[model samples]
Structures are given as C-alpha cells and as structure tokens.
Target: MSLRVAYGARRLFVYLVALVTFGAASPALAKEFHVLAFGDSLTAGYGLPRGQGFAPQLEDALRRNGVRAHVTDAGVSGNTVGQGRARLKWTLDGLKKKPDLAIVALGGNDMLRGLPPAQTRADMDAILAEFKRREIPVLVAGMLAPPNLGPRFGAEFNSIFPDVARKYGAALYPFFLANVAGVRALNLPDGVHPNFQGIKRMVSGILPSVTQALNAVEA
Candidate 1:
C-alpha cells in the first residue's frame, strides 16, 4: 500500500477504537445516581406544589451533602401496599432509567384502611423482594399506626418494615414522620398529613437515613 493510504487507514482505525472505548465507559461515566421515592401521599407531596414535594426537597438535601442524585417522586395519593404492588411495574416502566436506590415509603394507607397487618407485611415483602431481584438497593421507610388503631395493630404494622429490612439486608428509616408526628404546627387540618413546614422537617429528619442508603448503593 502507498504510504499516504496506510497513514490514513491507521488514523481511521484509531478513531474507531477510541469511539468504542467511549461507548463502553458511558454507563460508569455518568456520575449522577437516581433515587426513586416510592410511596403514598407523603412521598407524593399531597396538597403541595410539585417543586416543594418531598422528593424535590430530599434531592436538594442530597445535593447539599455532595451526593449527585435525582429523586423521582413515585408517590400516589391514597395508595395502600396492595395498590403499590399492583402498580409497581407500571411505575417502574415510566422511569426513564431504573433507580440506583429506592426509598420504599409505603403502608400508611393500609393502616388507615384497617387492612390486615399480615396482608400489609406480605405486600411489602413482595415489593422488597422485587427490588432485590432487580439488584436495586432499597431503604424501607416505616410508619407507626395511629393509637386509635389499637396497640396490637400498631405494633404489627410498624414491625413489618424493620422486619423486611432485616430479612433483605436493606436499610431502614424508622418512622417516616418522626419529627412531625404530634407537632400541631407541622400538620394540616386533618392532623394526619404534614403541612409545608412539617414536610421540610420530615425531609430533614429522613435525610441522614436516605444519605446512608445512598452510601450503601455507592459501596
């Protein structure tokens, strides 16, 4: 082959090789992680603006802590664990990218509806199992049943989350409403859901746990 032709062919080969390398490294090259905030009205930011929801606020908090992550709000108002499981696949399909970490903040609606504790646990177990099967790290956000639900019911409902976390080796954020539970200023007129300020407190209280969950994913 002529010298000029040989030089041109060699340069083309090098370009092709570089392009292939870049393609192979693309996934790891993307530094931002995705966190799917999967839950009920609490995660959905019921009665609040889209930008002020728990997911966005939590995303902001994550950024402040030097973690590059986008929190996808997957909350549906008045959803029970059964409902969440029924719609889980549809929700996953809607995501542009599968989440690296998922905060499973559900079951409160089940408690409110007086669903069987065993049923609630079973549904949650299935959800957690699905996440594990997909190799997605999960942080189970627990909820305490109202005292009016009876002591036995409260204990059973609250125990489901921690038990599932332990079984699946997932992170646990006990009591999703920890800081704003009885705080009158934090709740809305219903006394169940938190108001705007209460939501901020909720985000702050759960930030550490969510951060820890993200660290697990990084590890």
Candidate 2:
C-alpha cells in the first residue's frame, strides 16, 4: 500500500488492458475465419476430384491472398433454391460455430427445372433473412438464368440475387459462374458442372469479394 507500489500496479494494469485490446483487434492475431459455401452443384464440385471443389479451392485462394480461412462446402448436387432454404438450418447446425462469412450460391437448379421466379425469390429471401437475423455477414454468389430461359424469366430470375443481397445489406458477386459458364472446355461432359479448370476460374473471380467480406467481418 505504499504510494510508489500503488502507482506501479496501476500502470501495469493499464498496460495489460491495452495489450489485451490490441490483441483482440489485430487482424494478424485473429483466429482462422470460417466461411460457409452455401449453394448447389456448382459450389459442390459435382464432377471434380477432391480438393478441386469451390470450397477447398476458395480456401486455398484465400490463404494465398493472405487471409486465413476455412471454407465449409454446404453445397449439394441438384439443390434448388427451395431445397437450399429447407436445409439451411441443418447445415448451419452441423458447423462447430456459426460461419464468420457465408457465401449464398443457390438457385441454378431452380432455373434449370423451370421453376417460377417468384418461388426462387422467396426462397432466396428466406435464406438471406436467416443469415441477417443471425448477424452473419454474407457474400451472395449470384446465379444468372441462362438466355434460353426466355427473356422475362431470365430477367426475373436474375434479379433475385442482387435484390436479395441489397435487402440484406450483403455483398454481391453478380454471377457465380462468371468467366467459366457456357465455356464448353471449362465444363464437364454434362455441361452443367464445372471441370477442374472451371473451378479455378470461379475461385479466381470470387476471391476478391470473399476477401472484402472477410475484411468486413474482421472490422
């Protein structure tokens, strides 16, 4: 209880508090971020080999760009937007912790099956709403209805991703397929699934948005 002793103790406590605060806020000291790739076959790597899927490839890409991330593949082949919404809670429950960032990439199958655009929009809205309710940051990996789907249907289906993303205040990567879609060489024989090269291209295109989303999560 001497004056000098009390003063030293106070200073030490302040120093410790500052250290703890900095450690918590410093990105360099942060734990690995968990990212959920919540989508369908394109996100699932349907025809590709192990480690070549969107989730794994994206994880590797994030690391290469200096962000520590573990991407979980919640993608299932043949999943429509409605199916994705149905399984959303189950998939989230399976994770050890809630994802730091979620990439919503569903609806391709819905378009392929010729489902109504309104149904697709509703399913997407519910999915994004759940994420928002949980306070999870999202990067919507949008899917564009093919030109063959007819102009009106394509317009309506295509509008769902951006509109939902805006409503949820989420980041949008306009088209998940981007450079790889419709390229015969980049697709598998079935022409719906991406090949190894296609996966790489997709990863490259989306890496920037993923990084931005992680930055927001950290912030």
Candidate 3:
C-alpha cells in the first residue's frame, strides 16, 4: 500500500488503515478480481509480521467471504498524497496487468504535517484522474482529519476524500477506521496503528463497501 489510511470518518487522525500497494509478484494472481491496496503504514503492515498486514488479511477475508481476489500491497510508509501521486504511474506500469479495482487511501501524512488540504485534494484529483483515464474503477477509502487539529482544519481536510470521490465518480468509504479508533485496546503501544484484532475489525467494517464496489465495476 502507499503509506497509511481507512475505516470511517469517526476513525480519523488516530488509527491507521490500508494504503495502496506496489510490491513484487505473487503466485496465482489470476483471480476473478485483482485489487491494489494503496496507502501508507497501514497497508505496509508497519509493525506486524507477514500475512498479517491489510492487503494479505483483506485478501484472506475476501476469499473467506466468497470473493476470489488477489490484493497487492503497494504501500510506501510515510508517504503523502502528493508522493502517492508521484509514484502512481510507475507503479501501474510495473504491474503485470491493470488491476480491476484500486482501493486508494492517502492524505493522512499531509494532514499530520499540517499541509494545506487543498493540496491534498489536488493531488488526489490527479491520482483519481489517472485511474479513470486508465479505465480502472477506484474505491476511494476515506480518512477523517484528526480533531485535535481544530474544526476548520478538520472540515477542510475531511472533505477532501468525499469531494474527490464524487468528482471522480469513485466509490467512497467515508472513513477507513470506522470502529477501531478511540478504543484503547484496539491500538498498538503508540496509540496509533491498530492491533491484530483491530485490523480484523477494519476488514469487517469495510468488506461490504468493498464488495459493492467490486460488483459495480465488474458488472
């Protein structure tokens, strides 16, 4: 995945979620659905071990729920939305085939660094434009700006996800970390990244929206 991001608006600025991904090849990639989990630390599975990260776990969940899919982890830890846009072209080029759907989750780093929300929106626009140009259906996994940053900042930052999703005609998740944030036991020691059970909660939360997007695009 790209860096870190997901869940819903309430899960913002606290817990992490799946970002888009760009990694090496994997076996049996020829499934009914091919997805790219793009974002930051959440998708990269920063602290967790192999097969426990968002992409792999989500893939397992998808299969368990009866959708045959291979999710590629294309996350770049510490990346901003601009950075995610910077690498999008090459990432797509390097892929063996264009994915059926791309779950794009970014902008948290930009929000954390106190960068302009307009900038994040602009970069997101470019990223989604490219996806549309390439004929790829994208599910824009949303993020809420942390409340500590103040309401104005929150309004500006939070609106970016849905605004871009609407302008680009992408499916919107409205927030990637819906039920996992704010709960102490669900997070890691740093009070940010989710624990194993937390990720499961995220997977469960977003699975329905993800399934809907997949069906809409593939149909």
Clashes of 1: 0
Tell me the deviation in Å of residue 201 in model 3: 0.9
> So what's the TM-score on candidate 3?
0.84
RMSD of each: 6.7, 5.2, 17.3
lDDT of 1 by residue, 134-189 (tens): 88899988998888989999889889999999999999988999979889999888
- Alpha-carbon local distance difference test for all models: 0.90, 0.91, 0.85
What is the alpha-carbon lDDT of model 2 when measured against the actual structure? 0.91
Model 3 CA deviation exceeding 4 Å by range:
1-31
Q: How many clashes (backbone atoms < 3 Å, residues ≥3 apart in a chain or on different chains) does model 2 have?
A: 0
Please give the lDDT score at residue 118 for candidate 1.
Answer: 98
Error of 3 at 81 (Å): 0.4
Instruction: Give a tens-digit lDDT track for model 2, residues 175-201.
Output: 999998889999999888899999999
Q: Write the per-residue lDDT of candidate 3 for residues 67-167, one digit (tens) a residue.
A: 88889999988999999999999999999978999999887688779999889999999999999999999998888977899999999999999998999
